[model samples]
Target: MARTPTASAGRRSRTKTVLMGGVYVALLGLVSLIIAVAVATAYLPSYGELTKRSDLGQMIRVRAANGAVLVSLGPSFGEWLPYAEIPAEMRAAMIAVEDKRFRSHLGVDPIGIARSVKVRVDSGRWRQGGSTITQQLARNIFLTNSRTFGRKVKEIILALAIERKFSKNQILELYLNRVYFGGGAYGIDAASRRFFGHSADHLSLGEAAIIAGLVKAPSNYAPTADAEASRQRSGVVLNSMVENGFISAAAAAAVDPAEIRIQQTTRENSVRYFTDWALPQLDTLIDETSDPIDVWTTLNPGMQAAADRAIDAHTPRGVQGALVAIDRDGAVRALVGGKDYVDSIYNRATQAERQPGSAFKLFVYLTALESGMKPTDTIVDSPVTIDGWTPRNATRTHLGPVTLREAFSRSINTVSAKIGAQLGFSTIADMARRFGITSQLSTFPSMVLGTSEVRLIDMTRAFASVANRGVAVTPYGIRKVITADGRLLYQHEQNEERVLVAPWVAAEMVDLLQSAVMGGTGSAAQIGRPVAGKTGTTSSNKDGWFIGFSSGLTTGVWMGRDDARAVGNLQGGTAPARAFSAFMRVAVANRPVEQFETQVPIPDWQLTPEEQMFGDVAIDGNVLESMVDEDGMPLDQPGQPPVDQPFLQPGRPGDPSQQELDQAFPPQQAPPRANQYPQRPPPQQDPRSQPPANPSDPGAQLP
Candidate 1:
């Protein structure tokens, strides 16, 4: 129909306006498309001619404790296997559990992202991850696990590039070979060999599912150790596979727990214990150096071999033992943590805390000697009661009166308890701590009977301090850590704190310990040279220990069952001492016979009137009264807890090996028993002095 001229003009103008707007919108859309293409191109990597890169550049070469080449390790702990060898079931399981639409997506999945976002919104927390298998592979290869926007963007970009560069099969192969599968295994092949004792291509369906489950959390779902968790996670994977059409529901249900067989892989390593202890220290260096490093340790191959031999010869079947030998300077020369490192990797030498038994008497006696008590002084060896706790001698009989040296030699429990009460339990604990004991100590009377637990390394370190003539010692294995290019990373420097004990006290203790080996429970440790040592057997013989030292070396040996089962009447003198003797015989085969410096210049061995009174009070069961207030009443409440004392200072400033051997290990010296005690130092206020106050008094404080 014909319209008015003005109306027709209006219609034409509106049409022209609509046309212009359409053109503008089209231009804007084309520009946006061009910009998006440019950005994607910039982010993409070169794909036409892929340069094969090696993953071995990050390998680390760990040296033996003695600086010899031990082994080289890659960033991952297993050999890489090609994708062609990975089981088809494993590939399907990974795809099902990790990325359901992996075949359809370019790199990422929008559906998965939207689902993860909905989960976070509904739960009000970001617990779910939407990362596809491609994104994870890209992160594993080119980025770290940092959760930042920049890293996530780079991960996405790399994933896209990887998809463009390699086929879907290649991407899946790389993921299978590089993903961790628990037990320090890095790939499918390594995981299969470690868990199933077979090749990747030979993996059963259940085994493959188990391996796939571990990729989520290795420690929590390892099939070998966490079998139940692995089973449950594998069931989840199988369900996902059924839903994704990778497997039938009936087939997925057929994967039985009983059908999954895990073969025990052979992992026999002689230095495994030492390596287990050294690896953590190496990791610290790796974090600092960010490169391969070499660790020079103090372990001696000869001594280590001898220790292994000693354990094998002395320990019976099913009985385990640990041995640690250190020089006077506290450098660990040899360490054997178990009868066989292959059977177990639990480091008993540094990890297990067992009763020292009579071996603990060393600290008790040392404490008494440090308090100005003479070795020849008498201590009544009789059963005594303190707060209803009575300690009896192991022999079930006690001599009426015995000298301190004789009491220590015989390891008389009653006498040790009496002395511990006289000096106070805190003093003994302090002395032991000063000697490098880090284990928690008991302050009860039973502590003198070795009721407390101690690590073998600590016990050995304590003996090492005595062997060094009261020099402070820190038992250490790492000598130095350097990079492959010789850049220094770490060095064990000797500390210069004053020795916690006096030289005279250490010498006297050495003399008494020497007498112990000569005529006491540790006689089995005697090796034709002057040896100072002690033997200890815990209640029911659950733990047997012989901690001894020669002029040149200090060593500790222990024999026990890991379950704390009694070893049929095994005493410290029988097996542990023999082991110590055997190890020392090989350890000192080339060194000349050296004598322990047992003589320190002192006055005649005579008890002072105060000491004699203290001894009498100890014998009469009035030990606390003897250390009484002026009113003849006990100064301390019966059940008052002991206060902690300041630890002993370090030794004189010098090299740990600078001590004169002439004085440290003389070839010929007077018998320790013949040497007289030096005149006691001028008496001063006891460093342990404190104000008398009620323990329950809130205002009372220990200083």
Candidate 2:
């Protein structure tokens, strides 16, 4: 009996111990749950505070070198306005469009959230967001640009905390200050200013509705990007306002849609070509800081306008062209990459490499002139074949004998090839390199004809060197950058170096180029004043170019199709020259007229036999006084041709004057017959027959 009682007592004691342990575990679990809830509650308010203090709502402005606002990087936020400051119509529009239960809900609309969950569950994806205004504000302020459960949860927690700490009006005010509207505008006030160019307090009912509509998709409804979409969104907001009892249907219908005006922000985002080229130069002058910096450049707004107009007028539809203008000192004054910069951001002036064509011949001629060759030197214009490559003149027919000056003026291809062969190609290539033709030069002789490709800006710089008397100046866009407080951040000085030809040689080349504008290929580019220029038409007319310089400015224009095809039969002498002339006409209208120095007089010895022959050959005074027929035999001193008989039987050999006519037109008969004609004996070869080779040799490879 004693052992049985002991066993029962042991069993009862074990049961009691088990019951006590269960109770203790339940109590500990309850304590842990309470601690977790407390920690979450504590972190929620801190997250709200963090959202309030973040700088994500700030606006970032980009300024031009001349202190003009080019673009606003971030939201364009105006001054913070209280809820009271916001008009009732604006508030009503926001409530009707964004969240109808904004006032009654505790930061989360249960109905909206339930609908969003149902959508996600049905579609097996999170495609829709049911964020209230407060939640959106929280995300914009404190969260990263992510769409994940953790981030959503954080946003919700912050929103709940904000609602708990502030009244409905205060939360709405904060939300109004933090929302993003497209076009770099943030908050209701900035949106009002950006879209209407007015303060939020001055917003009309239709304007307020538009701003509220932008809350759904700012970029899609942005007035600047899509005016029709903005108008459609505004209609939706107006309908919502009527459905929510915020406005009567009759009053909404009475609103004239035409009266709603959307003032586009004229901040300079459209002129990206100029900014892209000028930004790097701007960086050298300004420090990285949030404060506004003003940059001053040498750019002339009028010149830039003229460049844009000229490009638009001359460039064919769907074709692309770029223009760059520099002052006498090599400061870039204007640049236009294409017809519409908004359609494409690639700055052709700095980025594209196209063949410069015959414009490059100037460098070749300059090189030869520097090497003791005169403009009057004679070069054979006959067929020239170098290393299996035959370069023909634009017109296949060649003048038997031509001076260097005439060859350059006429842009004769065979003569240029011959000149390249005489002067080592490497010498001309080296001169081009020194003058800032940084593009790769081909080893073949075609480089003498500008087979190498170059950018517009580089070509402008090279031409500017010629205008600046052989001193190559680095082209700069930004002159100086200053802080908002007027402190100088950086400044650019005139960085120049003497390269390639000497000053006198450069001056002489300039004079010759002026003749190009006066009567040669660049005649279309003549601007009344003294202008020196060269025209370049690439292979198959794929590219057209006109690079010219006046007394104070140098401009380069390029016209061609963006797809690398030929344009509407346009050559360098046509559209590009016209555009260059138009821009120069406007740019230099106020500047004083200046003349290029004339080339030094050619010495007598440097004259070639052909030039000497032409120098003495003269037409009869009677022929000059009256029109004559095809035959060289003079008409009867003025009305004598009426009785057209065999005049003097075409004088025989040994006739002094007849000898000159025979020399003029050599006999086309066989060689044996030529001996019978009145041809003067061939001149004896001088003992100094080994004259120096021509300075331009097409066979020689370029450096």
Candidate 3:
């Protein structure tokens, strides 16, 4: 084992050569790895890709007349926020929780990654995301949310590329706007509005903390779902901010998540019917190629809430209903297409065409008045037969001779049919067309009784025309369209209004409608103000409708089953008129009492001995409380609806209703969700609003 000095020297030289060779190989691998990273980073998405906007599409954000977001179609990215408009607290809170070294890091934060690894090892779970704000932005825009090693490498490369191409502020904006805040909300503006009821610009320190805390697990912490969990998460975010020197301990200590003011919402799901009805008109209102559009509608949230309340209160279970409220100018204030949107999106208010029953008498009487028949004129209410068809009054027995006003107020079917026949059915059809009733007309002898099916909107518009003093009312919902940044794209300009009737005629009609409410079937619709309206119920109790106006607001209500089956004991004067009263009470609460545009005095009419027995019959709920006689057989009352069948099948040639056909051959539909259209929601409550103990956030799918 003894070695010579020369051999020992040689062994030392070999060892030094091997150590130097190993050092050279290590340096070569490091340079190659650096080159590989540089190449991958260079190939990452370009600056425009990282900075691309999710709102660039023709996204439609539907809003209430008061600028409250109602619903959104397509990408529901909240309105964009510039770097300056982004709240300082929002920025600080997010950075303090998500990445402490975001301000100093180039793109990847090694310290954050190391800390995340240690935390994961210690806790045996992922406690921190470890990615810097830039990296998160890259992953959100370019890469998927995968934990694969290849994905991590690509995320780092893209993050470096993003940091190289964009400033830190730009990266922050992208990340904040792109991050999901749960409950379908995206972006701080939307998340803040969804949870805090205000925009991010107005976010308080507590609110900012709550929103920042959602990044870790949006679904788990959304205040709309669990206020306590969200509040706890907010505390964690506040503590992190204090630790990071972003906020003082005293400042964080003063915050209470429960005190955050969240906007109270009613049953807003029904408002989507308004949006669906208005969305189609967007293409006609403005260029479809414009930037993201903010569609301002004439929908009054208060009125909408009122309508929802009324429907929920009056509409019984297993029955569907719809309501449409419009201003004098035809600005649709509130529209409920159906009882539940998710159960059936088939909008009964706008799309369903069913027999309007006595509601159609508006046209017949309008024609009679236009033909110079005064309300004081004498008319016979006895039975009549025409073209081998006989129509019977709802009472089965008719009052002999009654004043025109009396017959109209009592919803006398024979009187209207006689007058319509005398004036010619063609003339009545012309009058219906003149007043915005667009559905097909049967024009037969019984057609004057609303035997022909018509759309609720058309029927509502006709009554609106009468309330508007004979000016045609086009029910419009969309008020204007604008860009996200408040640039005007379209402003609704009403078309020239055609005079459908002389002012005096309109006054005469108003007088007639007023008489109906004052002393007839519409007695239940009084809303502490003079109301002019008519109630309609189809045979077999298939449809119930009430169309009326009060305080310059005209509202129409329709209740029916989609399958057109009979609804037991439900009539226009009972449920529909009651709902109308409830809705108008809220709709006109603020407006000053408004009188009829033109009030032509009604001449006091002398009633016959027989008619005198039923004189002053305009008692409250007069028609509703007595819908049936002693035998319990269906009583045929004008607005209350008679159970008798029509003279002829209401559907003749050219009156084929697609709604009926669809009902006959029901189309395939997915079963409604378990909670969709939950049984008669309590009045003044949102069905889906599952606010936690704090109730800081109502469950509105924000984004």
Candidate 4:
């Protein structure tokens, strides 16, 4: 139907007005959205958050005594590179693989997010990441990698804020410099140098591709772990680059991933053991300082290598071994904790506690020596029971009468027990404590047999005192600790104390120990340099130990199964002695030969109160001389050990005649120079007499 011109014009005018009004409302809504975005961006964390410098993990450099880098632990970025310094190909590869529209997109990519959401919905899991490089950098710096919706919101806000605050080049530089690589390496510089042995500026196309691929999963695609997997990942990155038009197809195809040589920074297995032991020592001297620390250790690389070889060559399968070498000054030169550090990190040398067996007899004899008993004194090796605990000699034969030196050399258990009983368990314990054994000791008769367990390190340090002329020594490893800025934090100094009252006692001990290596159980340990040591074997052969020293060094070796099972006839003289010999040969190859210093004779006041009692009761020199047998055994004493139990002469089974007995106990013309009572000096409150010597002299009478 036709309408009048005025009515049609009116309806058309109303339609036009409605259309114009709708356009005005849409424009207002758009302005409001822009204002809201501007407000949110303004309220976001200040721009300084994106520009502030953050501290990356510091690098810890451990060096050997010779200035060789033993290990580099923690995160260390090789060098920081500006955006222009990074190779263009590296940037292209990272952008193509990590974010295709990195240059054009705001921090949050809507198209990528839509794609990721569709894929996640289809696969029923969050498989694909929709964030751009800016988002990743934001998360890495200010947020954790949690998959919660709140974290996603925070990431999107921070990414958009970063886009508003930082330039594209600045954002890219931060991303490249902060990304993590495998093997404790962080940033492109570190990744490039670690994988290709070249700086980031010199990275080849193929090398750049391999490093870029590690961003997805550093440990999984690390070149050191699986070169083929890393190569395949690099191929994917190269294809992405080509598809994104960042590189030509021909150029991408020309590069071969197989030719990329991964330069792996491998720490020496032996050096790692040393570092592990030394790292904890730093804390005692220095507290938590943000700066990096330099710890110089006393480990001798040559000696460490020698010790490693010795343990590997001598240790039986399923058996663990520990060795520690200490120099004359108590410096730990070499320490091998176990057969291998990789198989287990349990440091047996410093941690494990096992019976030292006869190695503990050194303390008992020292106590006896301090009590004025000479090494020439006779002690019956016949079997004796203490509290129903009978200890037989390892050889299973008793020498009816033997010199104290002979008893020690043979490692006679009965003689050691008798001597320990004579000194009283508490006295012996005090002696051991002074020598550096901190573990609790059992006071039973078996205590003399090392019934108490002790760490290998402590036992070795204890023996070092004997080597150092009676000065107690504490084992130390760290030589000095300095910060990166040249501040001295700690400097280890040798600590020595006079644990033994009489320095000459150490000399007498040296004599007896030398005899053991010369003709006794430790004969196999002789290294042709006047060596002295002891052999220790538990009853069931569960533990075998050899601790010995030359004039230059003292070493201890222990071998046994971890489960405490017997290893077929393993003795201290077998593998342990051989290992000691093998290691010492290399340890002292170029050093000058030195002899043990003569120990100053013990003074009279150093004797125990009981020993002084004898000095006070003066008797005729001839009578005192007659009282002791030729072998130095006190004769006709009250409570003398029974002699009729058993007797085995050298060439006969039955008891010998009086002539044989006389021959066995020959009269001593003079006591050992070390056994003589010192001549009394001018009287004081408690002045000691002269040193003991010249037993045949009338002044050498026993107390």
lDDT (10s digit) by residue, model 3, range 585-691: 99999999977754443211322332322223221112233644788554664432235644223268755476765655454454544233213224264221221
TM-score of each: 0.55, 0.63, 0.77, 0.69
Model 1, residue 431: C-alpha shift (Å): 1.5
Candidates' C-alpha lDDT: 0.75, 0.73, 0.78, 0.78
Comparison by lDDT, 1 against 4, better one: 4
Task: Pull out the clashing pairs in model 3.
Answer: 394-636, 636-642
Model 1, 1-703: lDDT tens digits are 7799999999999999999999999999667645644575466545322222234244344554655544335543344456676678989999988898999998878898899889989999866668899898888767898877788777776777677767898888778877767775667875876677667887777887888888788999987667788888888888888898988988988889666877643222555676566657665643544454556777777787788889989986788899998886778888889977767889999999999999998888888877767677898988798767898887899799999989988889999888776777767776787677888998877888888999999988888888787776777777787764577878877866445566777888998999999999889999988898999999999999999988679999999999999899799999999999999999988888888777665422233434333332432123445466686643433323122322222364542342453444333333334222222222263221221222234432111
Which residue ranges in model 3 land beyond 4 Å of their true spot? 1-59, 74-88, 103-106, 110-129, 167-170, 183-186, 197-202, 597-703
Tens-digit lDDT string for candidate 4 (275-296): 7777887778777776656678
Model 3 worst lDDT window (10 residues): 687-696
Model 2: how large is the Cα RMSD against the reference? 15.8
Model 1 root mean square deviation, Cα atoms: 17.8
lDDT agreement of model 2 with the native:
0.73
Compare the candidates by TM-score and give the number of the best one: 3
| Candidate 1 Cα outliers beyond 4 Å, as residue runs | 1-58, 71-268, 282-287, 602-703
Candidate rank order under TM-score: 3, 4, 2, 1
